[model samples]
Target: MSHEFTVEAGLVIFSYDGRAQFGWLDLKTGAYHAESDGRCIPDAIGAIEFHSDVTH
Candidate 1:
């Protein structure tokens, strides 16, 4: 499956099959994908979410 968040934070791709995974993140460029660990996302999600001070 996939997920997309429409905001100044750009889009996040949430994917899963038998295990949890993430990808396609722009990160420092201000746009990114859910390709890592993050605070805003669920721990089980195994995805990267943005921080309050997310810099570009």
Candidate 2:
């Protein structure tokens, strides 16, 4: 089984799967980012936020 959802934030759409995977597409640049091993969107969002904060 699989679970998925999509959220639009500004020019980007965040796509998430319940089975620890997700992807995001940037409407403007047509760029995207994807990864696995996330339990949920919030979990992955938190990790991305953390990574972004720490990296920059």
Going through the candidates in the order shown, the clash numbers are 2, 0
lDDT of each: 0.40, 0.34
**How well is each residue in 1-56 modelled by candidate 2, as lDDT tens digits?**
16543433322224445332344544485444453431223423311221121211
Give the clashing residue pairs of candidate 1, or none.
25-33, 26-32
Best by lDDT: 1
lDDT of 2 at 14: 45
For candidate 1, the C-alpha RMSD (Å) to the true structure equals 11.5
TM-score of candidate 2 versus the correct structure, residues matched by position:
0.23
After superposition, the stretches of candidate 1 with alpha carbons farther than 4 Å from their true spots are 1-7, 18-52
Clashing pairs in 2: none
Which residue runs does candidate 2 get wrong by more than 4 Å?
A: 1-21, 35-56
